[model samples]
Target: MQVIRNGFLSLLALGALTLEGHAQAVVAALECDFPAASTDDWNMAASTLQYYIDTARGWRVDEDSFSFDGTANIVVDGKDHVASLSITVSRQSGRANKTLRSEGRSLTVSGECRKMEASGRKF
Candidate 1:
């Protein structure tokens, strides 16, 4: 009876540990899209988004987007440009939604994906 109880408790502890590990998995990439924009516009928007993500601290360029371990803020300085943009990313899970406003235009993109593979030229 003692051995059986110990084994049961051990299994429960292992199961809880597994769940905790999965809950802390890092978000690998962000899937972004501009559905209403044209191909050229989408390309430009994706490029600008990538630029912002690249400039953020603790983030590394991963083909199209940026990858980071923890939470970070993406801030774009307007300078000679019209408007600036700011995006906050939390790497707790596979979920993200960010918006960029510039030159009287707003671009929104979302979805945290596993891989950084691009489907096509225009995002």
Candidate 2:
């Protein structure tokens, strides 16, 4: 009788732990930052970022664009515009698909156009 009771309690404990884990997985957020100079540059960066996000099998983007109120900081330096944009990307396993939140700055040079590098991790 004691053996049966112990087994039942162990099963109950295991079930509770499983439930807790599931709950935790259901409600969690991941955050990161991608730095850029201005809106046009950010637009280019966002395109590449979108490409990766779209290609990933299990990942989904939560928001589509960056709100100036939430994720953008702009500064003008002589002939250059410096911008920092914050973006959030999220994915759900089963029902809800995915989303991407993007924000950044654009650079426009008056004279000759030059090649520039955009840097950041997609995931």
Candidate 3:
């Protein structure tokens, strides 16, 4: 009976992992700098933003993001006439590019990403 119980528990754990996308995910933060875009610039003063990425779906930038398929890469597009911010990051290489526009001025920043502990290099 004990052996049977152990087998059942193992099966349950395996099922849970399977349902959760093989337990794959990536957690990281993006840090960037922006020069003065005039005083009327957007208030995105945060130097770093945390990301919670779903390898099969998409990632959230500090809990907000434009939805897109992020299996191979991360792509986001947030725009309007007054302001726009777009991001593209390769999941395999961890290279990132971001563009910010406000009040008719725009800036693009590119850099490598640092994955958090246990986050691994690939999503």
- Model 3 residue 97 distance off true place after TM-score fit, in angstroms: 0.4
Candidate 2: tens digits of C-alpha lDDT, residues 70-105:
222232342333243322233221111112233333
Error of 1 at 110 (Å): 0.8
Question: What residue runs in model 2 are displaced by over 4 Å at the alpha carbon?
Answer: 1-29, 33-71, 78-86, 92-123
In terms of lDDT, model 2 sits at 0.24
lDDT tens per residue, model 1, 1-123: 011101111211111123655542222333333222223232222331221233234545444434444322223342333333334444444344545455555555554433244432222
Lowest summed lDDT over 10 consecutive residues: which window, candidate 3? 1-10
Poorest 10 consecutive residues by lDDT, candidate 2: 1-10
Query: For model 3, how does the per-residue alpha-carbon lDDT over 1-123 read when each residue is reduced to its tens digit?
Result: 011101111211111145656773333433222222223343333244334344332444332332222222211244424335565666555566656554566555554554544543343
* Candidate number achieving the greatest lDDT relative to the actual structure: 3
- By lDDT, the candidates rank as 3, 1, 2
What lDDT does the true structure give each of the candidates?
0.34, 0.24, 0.38
* Model 1 stretches astray by more than 4 angstroms: 1-83, 113-123
Q: Pick the candidate with the highest TM-score.
A: 3
| Models sorted by TM-score, best on top | 3, 1, 2
Candidate 1 lDDT (Cα, 0 to 1): 0.34
